[model samples]
Target: MKRSELLTRIVITIFSLGVVALPLALWAQTPLIHARIAEGGGWNPDVIQAKVGEPLYLKFTSDDVMHGFAVGQMDMQPVDIEPGKVSETTLTFNKPGIYTFFCTRWCGLNHWRMRGTLEVTGSETNPPEPASPPLYVTLDLNLDAPHLAEVVPTEKASARRGAELLRQLNNLPTYQSPDYYRLRSSVQVFQDLSGSGLTDSQRWDVVAGIWQSNTTPEGFAEGKELYAQNCAACHGEFGGGDGVFADDLAAAGTASMQTMNGDMAMSMQTPANFSDPQRMLGASPALLQGKILRGGMGTGMPMWGSIFTHEQIWNLIAYMYSFQFDYPR
Candidate 1:
């Protein structure tokens, strides 16, 4: 070979080696979401947002029937795994947008229900932090959403069924208050959240916030003021259950806390005296708050939920606990 050609070939080889090494070096440093696939219908990661050009190493398996995984834009073919076998595939996404994957197998009746989404984000040196997941109050009954919701065979039916189930479970018909109505209507739809979308514990906290709320006054003085504004009207300015509204309220069944308790005593209701530490001793702050919010559903006791803020409610509860001791009579 000529001297000039030989030198040129050597340089080109060296440069090509560096180019190949560069991408692999970057891949070595890149982080991956590791997960195991089992008898589930969908991908272990149903929803994930990743940077473009990043590799997704899916350690997937299927112990039931044959399963397939495919991404349309990536020109990727479905990787199939038979029953009792492990399967894997490395997909390096080059596009910057949302991509979806689904099981192309008619494994079962819920085969269409098995799908997930992936969001390939644009190239940026420092990506912004992901937003916090919705509170349980925000979780839709439709486990598959926006994109995932489309692929379902009976989308409308699934949504309708899910909505009905939620209403029945939460006792929506008997549940009053505009707040609850709004909440019920908001969660009628569904979304898929099989991936690391939101941890179970976080979802539970959101549920807790929706179903219950409790807060204690910072200290005694604040508690006293809160009591005066909310409770004094019925319980008396001194927490003696002798305010001006007390008599009228008693006639309505709500003002008479003791009587209401007795009428519902056979049931689960336990109306305790705010001033009687013995009666109120075991009552939890949360339980007390719920009791006060709901009132007697079918009875004369109207729900006072609209009248008090969350903070005020807690403070009032604290003040009720304090009623055990007379305020200088």
Candidate 2:
């Protein structure tokens, strides 16, 4: 052959070789499709569709027990899966069709059914777009009518005061989990105040009747002492709303002095004005008792009916009535 023709022939051969290697280069550059073997015996998805020539990458996990992940009839190692653990693999599917995978290990009776399929199509490319936001909703069955009721005392006496204390606790805010966690300190304080030996019911009785009338001045003094011992931290000694726990209670959105500002409009909620003569003066003993038993609705007032005995509630009422005598504006 001529020298020029030989050179031209070599150039043509080089160009042809480049054309032949181009497809292989493109194939090596294909993106991989990654998937997981999630716990619960089921793949996160039982079916996956991929375009031919795309690389397949598999990720799997077993949240409960050990299981095997085999794809397209290919034998895989008996990977010991554990709870909260995961495994993965990569395989390229050159052909288009339905490919199935199953667990090879004896993962229990349902191991046979612990299988899934992947569909491969050549024409389509790109995954489908997500249609909507993954919105989560919950039905709160516990948030219906308040779990409290009001009761009226038949007479105006110290027991009504006891009933009011019950109302205070009953109307306590619906504590969040965090709030309850924070209450640990308050619980300790309360336990120290009433002593731990008392049952929940007894402690409530002490708190309710600690402030009421007494057959003697000494009895009344004893009641006041008890109030200081068991109730002063939250209700204040004079019931003027200053309490050791008031700030913490308010921070946790519990009712407190700051919440019971004089102007009902500035108050966190409409607080019961104990000094209001029209509201308090005309109230019959029965009405006052009822108010103590059943706290005002939608406020932090709670039902004290179950917390104090009827007699205890009456004594507390008399003590509260004494507030009128001492602090009548």
**Which candidate has the highest TM-score of all?**
1
lDDT of 1 by residue, 148-180 (tens): 112221111222233334354554333233244
In the range 9-80, model 2's lDDT, one tens digit per residue, is 999999998898886576455432222333343655677666788767655656556666666333344444
Off by over 4 Å in 1: 1-219, 252-272, 298-301, 325-329
Tell me, what's the RMSD of every candidate?
25.6, 26.2
List ranges where model 2 is wrong by over 4 Å.
Answer: 1-226, 229-231, 247-279, 296-298, 326-329
Q: Model 2 — TM-score against the truth?
A: 0.26
Clashing pairs in 1: 142-190, 142-191, 143-191, 143-192, 144-191, 144-192, 145-191, 236-243
For model 2, how big is the CA root-mean-square deviation? 26.2
User: In lDDT terms, how accurate is model 1?
Assistant: 0.47
